[model samples]
Each structure stands twice: as structure tokens, then as C-alpha cells.
Target: MSENEHMLAVRSRINDLAAKAKTPEGLTEAEKAERADLRQEFLANFREGMRSQIEMLQVIDKDGKEVTPEKVKQIQRDKGLRDD
Candidate 1:
């Protein structure tokens, strides 16, 4: 599946597990483990998406100076989003 589709599936499963945990029967140990793993995967994906956004960022001052951080600029350069 595409990234968006996969993320939606993961989110659906996580919500399902959460609902199961709230019920009287509650979740089995395996379900709990699966929920934990899914949460981690979700978090990892979120962080990577945020990182990509940051890497593509460019900060410009009102005076027209490029004020982006050196590290971020380097990342953007490496990704071919910047000339230097």
C-alpha cells in the first residue's frame, strides 16, 4: 500500500485496539503488545514526516536574509532543495 494508506491502516488498527482495551473483556496480552508496537511505528512515522518538513524549510528575515539554521540548510542542500 502507499504511505498514506498504510498509515491509515495502522491508525485504524490502533483505534480498534484502544476500543478493545476499554471494553469489559479488555485486550489480550498479544493485543496490548500489538498496540504498543503500532504506537511506536506511528510515532516514528510522525517524526520522520516532521523531519522532512524541517529539512525542506527556509527561514527568511524581513530584510531578505536567509536565516535558516546551518544544520537545516545542510540537510536541504543534501536533499537538493538548496543550491548551497
Candidate 2:
């Protein structure tokens, strides 16, 4: 499938799973398993999206110093921002 179609399918599945989770009956063992699977899928997609965003940002900031996670956290700490 194309990227748009794939993203739409993922979003639709996420919405369906969220609706199931919100019901008062709650999730059964099987539904809980399905929810875990959906959560994993969503996390994987989110991580991939973040990586793409980082790549795009790197391209945009080509003239700037490359910032690693460790460095960013250190900078946040130095600025008195919450690291946790």
C-alpha cells in the first residue's frame, strides 16, 4: 500500500482499539492481548515517525552542530529544565 493508505489503516485500527478500551466492560484476556499488540504496532510506527522527523531536522540544521540525545539532555539540565 501507499504511505497515505498505510497511515490511514494504522490510524483506523488505533481508533477502533481505543474505543474498545474505553468500554465499561473493559478488556478480556484476548482483548487485552489484542490491545497490547495494537500498542506495540502504534509505538513502532511512532518511533519510525520520530526517526523521520529527526532526519528532516538534521537536514534543516545542517549548518549547526549535530545534537545527540545525551547532549540534549545535558543542555536541558544545564538550563534547569526537568530532565525526567
Model 2 Cα shift for residue 16 (angstroms): 1.9
Clashes of each: 0, 0
Off by over 4 Å in 2: 58-84
**Candidate 1: tens digits of C-alpha lDDT, residues 1-84:** 999999999999999999989999999999999999999999999999999888888899999998999999888788888887
Candidate 2 whole-model C-alpha lDDT, 0 to 1: 0.68
As a TM-score, model 1 comes out at 0.90
Q: 1-84 in candidate 2: lDDT tens per residue?
A: 997688678778768777877998766788778767867887888899986565334222466865547655555566665344
TM-score of 2: 0.52
Per-residue error (Å), model 1, residue 41: 1.1
Among all windows of 10 consecutive residues in model 1, the one with the lowest summed lDDT is 75-84
